[model samples]
Target chain A: MTLALPAAEAARELVEPVLREAVARLDPLTARVARYHFGWADSDDRPCAGGGKALRPTLAVLSGRAAGADVERCLPAAAAVELVHAFSLLHDDVMDDDPVRRHRPAAWTVFGRSHALLCGNALLTLAGELLLEQETPGCAAAARALNEAALSLMAGQALDLEFQGRDDVTREECLRMSRCKTASLLACACSIGVTAAGGPASLAGSLAAFGAEAGLAFQLADDLLGIWGSTEATGKPVLADLRTRKKSLPVVAALTGPTAAGRRLAELLARPEPLAESDLHDAARLVEEAGGRAWAEAETGRRLDAATRHLDEADLPADVRAEFLHLARFIATRDH
Target chain B: MTLALPAAEAARELVEPVLREAVARLDPLTARVARYHFGWADSDDRPCAGGGKALRPTLAVLSGRAAGADVERCLPAAAAVELVHAFSLLHDDVMDDDPVRRHRPAAWTVFGRSHALLCGNALLTLAGELLLEQETPGCAAAARALNEAALSLMAGQALDLEFQGRDDVTREECLRMSRCKTASLLACACSIGVTAAGGPASLAGSLAAFGAEAGLAFQLADDLLGIWGSTEATGKPVLADLRTRKKSLPVVAALTGPTAAGRRLAELLARPEPLAESDLHDAARLVEEAGGRAWAEAETGRRLDAATRHLDEADLPADVRAEFLHLARFIATRDH
Candidate 1:
């Protein structure tokens, strides 16, 4: 997933060192947990470059720059957002019983489950402490954003948990849960970025809309890949969500409608045992046949359209606007 | 435990309502977590008093009064400490896997462990948010204290988990863990009370020292009960720590001595099998025969002495001094 320049390149220069130092600051045990989970360190705490994609921090820094601020000044804020995102992923992996993350064993798999929990909690406190270091409007906005985002993260998590195994879940419910589960935190991340930069008044509103829509698009893309992408590309078994009984947007949309494939899905859901290896292909066929694939693609395109509209409304310098537009388009269309 | 208040209580008429209101202002879910943990709400979120001894909050209020501040002024600080304590208890229950809390099923046992985790995290945030409502000198001190205590708590927790299976762990290691796990937070709580009171310049040192010793006393008493208390009194099975191979102070001291009883205990440790219920009696007998219990009692007394010395050094008013002294005596000597 190569991103468009100016925004992405400038963000890379600002975000990498800040993230590196933050991970370095973790005491030995914390560092080990982070390094292993982020693929940066091995089980023995030795450092490696097995780091993450850092998409969230990139968005933060790029948004800061696009708002006409020196993106470097917002490194702490960007690091904080990334830390929070990583922490959420750590916990989400546990909550979702996801064994593979980025093609490696999840943090809870490497460290003991409770150890992962403590690491997540520590990261959260560290995030708060980091925010306390920021000056004026930044500190104030960060505190608000961190707490609000945490609350929304919990709500999103709860909604996801609530959706598990429920075959009759509605598309609107899936979309709403997606907004809370995925979009709110992303939107808050962008808002905090702009807030740290003392962003232009006109840009905040549009940037926020763009972030929310971007988040929705991202989730839609992810759900689509869960069913349709090849394991080589996504590093996940196709129809993984269906196997886990995850009520993703596509699956719920299919379950809500009554087509020949939908009836087969209903019959499949009636089974009490785990899906066999052979069941995945059949499940994918039924899901696609019931319009799950098309519905998800349409939703993805719709959300991407709205996100672009918000980027246009952002009133950035022409070059910055072009950069944001390119980046948004890349995120919406990325394969992995 | 019973407390001997000053002959004439301080006029603390105004603070209670504000504290109540601050707590009431919490989100409904947060209030539910707090109220349920406090025994003021049932598992279903119906209203009921949680009924555990609100010992920490009482200490905060009385300490505020003794320092010449109106109790009304210190209620938020008092409530904040209780919230922190509640959060600790919520997490501790999960870590320990203790099935019961306050004569009822632990939060994890009732609400499920994940929800318990979320509840604990929420209360920690509430602790910070509640403190922010009143910007007394206590605010920064309390924030710093809570942050430090939380960090120390995690350290102690890490050490405790690390020491879980080993019987040869040193007494010094146990003491260090105890200080981090129990003493620091207690001292922080007491110091925050004094800070909340806007007390005389000379009083802070004594309050801190007093708090630290009192905390050690609290842990000592706790260790004693782990070995000797009845199941009904402790709300835990008899010799629970012994069965778990906890490297508590008594067990640590005995293992080091290698006395006859210690040797026998060490032999049992090598077995690495489930301890029979009958073994608890023998474990306690061996621990006593190794003189571990006697040493623990002496250490408890030493800490009580330190606390009393600090209390006397403060040169508090006769009535205030009497109340604190009585409380300390009760703490160091309590049977349950």
Candidate 2:
């Protein structure tokens, strides 16, 4: 509650230019795709301004600075993390068949799956290329982190997709899925920050601890928003996850819970047809009634607290630790 | 015909260890995927008989050696190119929906699309990582070349995919696609070889020329086998491209040719359902009647000759260009 950190300002200053320079250097075709994803330009190489929040890159650069590293020196690593995040989003939107993104048409809907696929792949390659240009041990270190993060993201997505329509989803499974899908990348981001500073191994451990806790809290907030957050606040329909029959943590908990709503939730899930808006609202109410909402919110708060404690223990500069303090609190509280 | 170039063999020797060493360093999950792609292990992680031709890496290493660079020094660069080729194949199969590859189930099919996708992406990162190591300027150079190749591959694939439904695919378009999908990597191969050798820019130019020619010849053989060869010969069905209505060189040529079968070829392609096996056989016959196979085969021979000539003109030690020489002849003449 007492976040006195300037994470947003620190991130903006650290990342904006590195991203600019990275895209500027791409070949014509790749640059076009890179530019498009960054909201820096359109498909035809014209400039635009709709790219989403540069969250991962910000985490990366800040982590570096927090670890006593020159943020500028680690810009490529930061850029690589951002590129990887963008690429993942591009493909994920397609696979999920989600049409709108960043308040506009998703890449697949606009350029078609073929071009979207290419653009996604190009970002993946471009990220490595960015890391590949770094001096000394940074290139190899960044590449390793990025590779692991990518693999985990894919695996987590696969698990999520696999859980679709399966009523037997366990709490443990959802936790594992969340860890892979969210924590791995955050962990990677923190690791990249550590790499930037050539920080001690403890930095790696500490940042990952912060990242893991933040990641779990972030997912909890996402689930909470799915059911109860405002549409403007979340940029998605309230209870969109329920409408789509997603096996979110709250939903899974409610489905298997011992309450009147729990049995009804199971029956509704069994219905093959798309849920009506009224049905979605009822489902959210049922999940909340089954204590899913309160449980998730409490867990989120606990994790955020843990993350802050880790930041305190990380031995980073007080000012830099303050930034993580703000970010961790923000993660638990964000609507989207 | 007189390749006698020891360069290719030396390059091969240099590449295997570098690649093996890189793979040895992979984290458990990544190592699993890496081994599968390298042909050292199967989808389930069981040992396999062969991995690949290792063509691209060999080209990089050999070109460097032939260009008078130290073969030992260029190992990572060579390995990087090999990784790029493997990465491309993994993604290409997914895009094409090809079920089988490398004498096994396509990586995507075996591992599921999500896992396959990540695996390919991880390999791509590894390729850049291998190149970006501190001791090697070739890392950055290879990264640039590999990225260019990746872009070209995507462009070529897009063009190839787009060409599928269009009856008006031109010879020039097909040729350009070939250059992008095939020649660019090969050209990168040869160019990287020289870069490893610490090139004169002139070395890059000549090597690129050689690569361009060789790559064209390489694809030409593939074009031929796509129509004339059997599954046993090519490990894929003969007339398979036509069956899938792929806008391959032979198919494009037949469409443009002035003949009765050419007209019928267009007519059949216009049909909505997939071409029946019997219909595919007929389509193949019609392409022959339209002189499609002959034209493609002739082009293969011509390009092979040109590739050999480039090596000869480079006037390197007999062994330096030897592998490429053999590879060229093999591409033109192999059953597959």
Candidate 3:
């Protein structure tokens, strides 16, 4: 946890300038949208201070460092990952109809949905252009990784939206969606960092394995926070997922569980009207009673352990391994 | 026009299979959405016969042929351009809220806006991946061209949307938007086709100039049809752009003209209520009286002439030059 803030800050310091440069390559209108979305500008186009946590870029740069590359050499790959993350968030916020992001109105709410969508696409294109401009063989491999992860991310989002309309979403289906939605990009970030650093495919594979496990753990923690974390800590309303009847891991686990509480949870969720505060509380209790909370907490520990094993097995210096572990642990246990 | 239909058919036969194969890579839910968007599948998930004109792909393949390469070497580039075109159309439909495309309900209308947007993104990623998988150095240049064109296209769309709210859009601004939104992709298509065929940058440059001029001519023709063509030809209600108050080239020219007809046209367009059928006819007449239609017609002819001159100067076989001219003329004069 201690290394987490410093690692993110360092990554942001190196990558944000490159990201800004890439966004500036867009047309003035699109550039304004990109700046506002990235928290470099407010809705009125003034400078702001609400950028992202830079977690993905941190992983990219650290993974490169662990593979014996200089930080400057990793800047393009790191910035690419951060741009992809921002692109997905922009589109996902519009699709999910969520009105807030990072303690402010979402980009779609500020700029309108069409502009947000177009700007997201512009960022994505810029991400690829950044890698291509590097003109290195390793950059080509990194670009391929980014493309594969982007495809998986879109497919995962499609599934997530599809699940919203159905009550029969299975645990396996939810797991698959989560793997694509969260783990694939994280895995790509780790692997592409090393790939861009001229690491062998085998080494990238090991790092990717570590990242995927850590990513799942992060998702579990995120879902738990959706139900129980403080609004200040999570930048969302308390029990926000339940109020929106989101089919997160715990909710799906409880919905498909073999218990009376599970059936009641489903019934509560199936009602056509929006859930009242009392109903949201009742649903949270039912999810716990059906053993969903216990299962998720235990599974999170298992994933974290698997992730640590990956780092332990990778041929990295002790300090590099510690940094990876600190980052994984920090994301999985942030304020919870 | 005789060569036009045959060339398009040839390109479709070569490129559609590859395009279909690339789309098949998406996860099932997303793949379904993609299939629907491409007109390979109906809304009920059954196979359908409705697809695009394959104009961009034809241009890509023909440009390669004109650059002294075999058609097989150009398939990937052709498919990549087609995918980019489809991606833009998907997003553009959502942004413009146009309910139809190519004689059918638009993808956003049938699959919902969110799925349409995601599927569009999926196609875009697929386009880049298609280039990378070729493993040829020429494909790298093609990828760069595609990325640049995609960015310009987005910028143009943003401007187009911004113009929807304003009454002071200049003729220069409209021309710039048309260049970015329409000409850029077509230029990329021609340049990438030549680049992918191992042609020099100079050759690609000439073909891109030809394609850009042809593309502007195509846009001018399309805008005219938007105002005057039959539904059977343009696949929308008559005067569709007028109904939506689209600031197309001729409309902008008329609105900014120094004639009384121009002033009357502006007042008519600025009214809050929807225009009646008679009003649409009157507006169309005003555009003509104000010299907008005459100006656009003359410009289209000039662009087509320039495009043909570029083809004549390029070191292409006689038949290849003829084919390119035929395609350009066909698009510029379709059903007009």
Candidate 4:
């Protein structure tokens, strides 16, 4: 999850401390649980090295800079977005019952579901606290945008859960879920910085559009990796999404494709037992043969182009536009 | 439960519509789940008549009026506190794995755990959104106070979960958890109206103190009911908390009481098997004989007195103070 672009790496470095400070404001027990969930600490409360990719925070800071605001002034918005992201991840793991996250046991696995759930709640509240800390002119708008994104994120999660175990899920439904679950937060992340800086709403809208497209591209790439990426690189099992019978972009595409291969893939997926390694491989192959993989790859490229177009239309400073373009490309092409 | 106080009934009528409006602002699916959880809708997604007691919102509106703010201006703050209360109940039911709420199947029981959990998240985010809706001078402060209260509430829930299945939980620990889990939100509900109206901080503090005391008294009464109240009255199984071996205030008091009956009660509670109907009766008898009921009753009276004192210290208008006093008394003595 290394940042390929120097600007992304710089934004990550700039935002990490702010995130740490914001999380530190939680009560001691919640702070400890949150630190563990963020990979900043271990079960024994000892320090750890690993953390998230910081993509949302980086987008926030870069978009702030692109909107003609100082990067330092965007730190709270950056940290706030990251908190919301972390909150979603914590709850998502509980909802998905995922045993692992970030190359380690998931927070729910380590701290129990109750603790993880409450930690998520605390983080969500803390995000609001962070957004209002400075009393800036843009704080109200920023808070509103963040809350709207949060609500959309939860609605997306609910839809995702509803889509599970249903064989009739449409590709359109999957795409909508992806947009709501992933793109909404990313779009907010892109816009929150500008809003926090009191920049023009028009610029914020363009950056949000850019971020939304980039987010879709990122999710499409992720869906591909979930089936095809190496375990070493992705830090997850091979065909992880298929193993859970997740109705992700590729699976939905395969399930609903107009081909005999799609029917066979659905038949294979309908088996009641846990998917064996051989079954996973066969499912992945069937999905690729059904044109799901190709469709996703093409969609990723389309979204990336749309994202670049939005960035260009934003009319940001040349260097900032170039940096955002680099990050968008990096997201579309990243292996993990 | 019926509101015995005219002020409580009036506040409910005022705040219920506001809460419905705030919830309506959520995306359709999330809003459906929220309305269902609040008992405003049935399992078929049609409208229903029953709902919560609206204690938090009532407190908020009354506290605002006591602070000299128009009740209309306090609607958003009132609705926001109710949302927070509903959010806690949704999550708490999941964590407690309780099957009943407001005399019906719990939201998690009816809508499933995932929907309930995500709905709770959406409601919480909606609370912040509602708080920020009016852009009042005290919006930032109101949002801050709400978030802080939410954090404490989660921390208290975390502690409550930790205390489960433990035999060594002290009375002091139980009381602290009660305050965190219940009193914090009540206090926030008391203060948010004043903050939202830009009233004096001192009045807010006094009202919050009053609410906190009343909250503890309410919880104490609830603990007593959990052991002694009939199923018909409490809308729960008889001795429900005892059946779950909850470390509630009365149970903790009985467990730590310096009486021979306390030791006898501890021995009875230590049985590994689930308590039978006869055992529940014995447990209730033992608790009363150990003076747990007497102690809780005395404590509730003390808290009610302290709450009235705080109300007196708040220097509110005479009629408003009388209304608040009536509400507090109703909470402390309610049968359901």
Candidate 5:
């Protein structure tokens, strides 16, 4: 993956130091939890190699570059976006009761839940602090963008939680939730990076549209992996979403379809008891037979095409365009 | 309380509308939870009278007034402070597993922990949004102050959680935690109010000092109530602190004291089983016999005096001085 997009490594290098400095501002315990959650260290605070792909930060850096800004000027915006992302992940893991993240135990699993909650609060506060620390012309605008995205992300998560109790979640509702939960912050990262670099608002708009589509497609790929990807590749249990009956894109598509397999999948999901391994396997098969997997695949390609179209509209230099296309493609097709 | 300090009512009137408007921006489910948490609605979404004293928002309004800013100009700052307070209470109740707040069931108890958590996230985000929406010169400074207070508050909360497992908590460490958890936000409320109104930094500084002292005094009063106040008055279970083995100011003071009663109190708190009702009663008596109650009372008075001294140094109008002093005294001496 690093070989496929060397820019990811560069973005990590540019943003990780800033993230470390910001997280260090936290109280000792919270900072320790944050460091471990970011995969910079193990639960015992030993150094480790378990970090995410830094995809959002890469998008932020790329957006700044497309706007002809130096990487230094983009540092705060990039780090702020990643901090918000981390904050959401920490809270989401707790809310969802998931035990894994970035191929490692979730922060809440290692630390206590309350400590993880405080760490999430600290990270969100740090994100605002980072934007405010920058004395650039675009600092306030960047802060506004980040706040808007955070609010939208929370709203999306709320809807996702609401879906857990109901068996009638529609495909449109699922997409809206995904847009709020996943796409808003990605769009904010792109727009805020350009804004932080004092880029033109028009360029930021195009990049934002590009990011929204790419983010949705990225979520579709994630949903696919949740149901069928190898545990080794995804670093999560196989068919985890099926076992939990998560209302992900593919699951919603399958449940809402008019096929007999779709009806059977819905009935399986509505059961009171936890799904067994066999039941989960059967449910996954039903979802595929009902065309959920194929629909999600098609939707991913369509969204990717739309994202590339927006990038084309930006009239970027060839290298910048190539980098964005490669990144968008990766987001739409990654196993993890 | 309202008759004794009309400013409290005035502040509520000024800030509640702004808070409502901000909360209305959240997703429907979150907005409902927030409305209930704010005491603007019940669990069933009906109107309710249950609410806190709005002390933090009142402090903000009074600080703005002392700086010659109109009540209108102070709305954002006042509401932002209250929102942060609400955010903290929601998260704290969840973390502490408290069953009640403001003479009503805690939001987490009524609506589930995840919903309450998301509502806290929403409120915190709304606070930042309120500050940013203000286009005044002092808006950035106000946001910075709020973020700093929030960070300090989380640090304080982290330490408090850390203290739960350790039997060796020092008085100094406990005081530091109280300053971070309680006083920092109060000071921020004062300073941010002035900053939002474009007041002099010197005035903000004096008001912040006053608020910090008063806030500590307020915590002492709360700790006293946690042990002795009637459930009807305090809106919490009597002897709640002892039952939970909470390391509140009084308990810490008692545990660190040199008396035999203090040593006995430590032994009781260290036992693994849940403290029975009789054990809680015994622990309360031990804390008092160890002079914890007396010390907390004297310290509250001293802090109140220090608060008034800072207010005197500010050279406010006679009416403003009287208002601040009345509020400070009320805070130090309140039974609930």
Candidate 6:
């Protein structure tokens, strides 16, 4: 996904140094694991151009500006949110047993499960340490927000794990899990910026709402990509989610869809054997035919609209609001 | 181990409800996992009598009193320390791939590794949440201490994992691991009480030192029990550490000793086959013959003495000093 918005790009650049400094505070062993995971260095500690898009930190920076706070003053909040994101990624890799992330072998694959797990724990504590180090007017409130978000994130992950290999998982359960697993941290990322800046609680709450909707849209789009996006773009094999039998949004929607195609999809999924390449191709087509693709597309648009409404209600400065608008659009439309 | 000291018993009783309340703050799924792990409930949620001796929380409460604060005011800090300890146990069980804990199936065995891991993460965040809820004097300092301890604890666990299946691990490395994995949290437990109570830095530092030495003594004693203690008393299989080829203090001591028995012990450990009962017995005998048993005993005594000296140097009230001394002795002497 291209970051066409110069302001978003600038915010990401602004957050990079703060994120590096915060991660650098970990002990040597954990720091190596974290740095390798972040794509800052290879497993051997050589430099590599690897890492996520820094979307969450940019959201924090923009939210701080939208709340009339200096972006510099909101840096700790930005770093804390990014650290939480990294912590989740590390743990999620282990939980999903994913072999690859960001087009490379996952951290757990390189460092071993135990080291990856401990490094994730260390990163989590470091997030709290960074927030406490802020030592500013609203640091306590920001810390509280971050901790609450972290609890919800883990709870969401528990629910996701619970849903695995279960045939009865409902659409409502999937949506709630998504909210907890993805949306909660993103919402916190938006709100913590405002709280750190000592902005009005109302604005913070509104931004959180905005972010929650944006996060849902983001996840829905990702679910679509998991099944239908190009392998070259996603850095994953074709229909990788289908191969793993992952009950992602689109798959769940298709399984629960009250149609012949949906029933056929269920029968295909319930087979004891692993899905072959031909089976995956058929499953993808069945998901599309079962209205899963259309449903997710509609939901993504609906959530994006809801997110924009929250942003509008937040009454941000015109320029800041436009920047947020661009970001929300980017999240909803990004292909990779 | 019986709590013969009246004050130690009182401190434990006082901290129990606070710990329960802090854990109760977790979301329903994580709470169920944590409750099951703590032996508060069976896997099916039926009531059960389970859990560790509330050692860490009692230490926090007693340390607060020794630092000239009311035990009631130290409840949050006490609960936070206990939660951290429980978090470590849950994750450690996963890392060790152990099947039982406290004479029951381990949490990961019942709930699966993902649930246990997430529950541990939830408990950790809850500790931060509990400390933040205090909003009283010195809360930030207490939170900082807890975070630091958590980082050290994870680092220590990483080191322990690294040492596994490796024969070259040194005595110094084992001691450093013990300090980080066990003593760091204990030290935090002690210092957090003083920080929570707004006590002097000197007293806090001294109490932390006392706890560090006590923790080392406690671990050394535990290593002895792992080899020679009764199965009924320790609620573990005979020579459990040796069965797992764990590089505990005594084992490392035996391996590094410059003697024929030590060399023989190393050869036995290097074998690919699992140790039979007779092999375990022989290994135990060799450890003693190689002077591991005597060395650990002497070191435990030295640490206990050093711990007592730190406690005395803190200038606590005579009554409080007596209680701390009694607790330290109990820790070094406990079997189960």
Using TM-score as the measure, which candidate wins? 3
Docking model 2 quality class = acceptable
Candidate 3 residue B299 C-alpha distance from true site, Å: 0.4
Interface RMSD of each: 2.7, 4.0, 0.8, 1.2, 0.6, 1.0
Candidate 2 residue-wise lDDT at A184: 84
DockQ of each: 0.32, 0.31, 0.85, 0.77, 0.85, 0.78
Error of 5 at A55 (Å): 0.8
Ranking by DockQ, best first?
5, 3, 6, 4, 1, 2
- 10 residues in a row with least lDDT, candidate 4 chain B: B1-10
- What TM-score between 0 and 1 does chain B of candidate 2 receive? 0.91
What TM-score does structure 5 among the candidates reach? 0.97
In the range B261-300, model 6's lDDT, one tens digit per residue, is: 9999999999999889999999999999999999999999
Docking class of 1: acceptable
**Candidate 6 runs further than 4 Å off:** A1-4, B1-5
lDDT of each prediction vs. the true structure? 0.72, 0.75, 0.89, 0.87, 0.88, 0.87
Model 3 residue pairs with clashes: none
Writing each residue's lDDT as its tens digit, candidate 5 over A206-312 gives 98999899999989998999999888767888998887888999999999999999999988888889889999999999999999999999999999999989988
Clashing residue pairs in candidate 4 (N, C-alpha, C atoms within 3 angstroms): none
Query: Which is superior by lDDT, 1 or 2?
Result: 2
Evaluate model 3: give its TM-score: 0.98
Which whole-number lDDT from 0 to 100 does residue B258 have in model 6? 100
Q: Supply the DockQ value of model 6.
A: 0.78
Error of 1 at A285 (Å): 2.7
- Candidate 1 off by > 4 Å: A1-27, A66-72, A135-137, A197-206, A258-260, A309-320, B1-35, B59-77, B132-141, B193-209, B308-329
- Residue B226's lDDT in candidate 4: 91
Fnat per model, in the order shown: 0.13, 0.31, 0.80, 0.79, 0.82, 0.75
Q: What TM-score does chain A reach in every model?
A: 0.93, 0.92, 0.97, 0.98, 0.97, 0.97
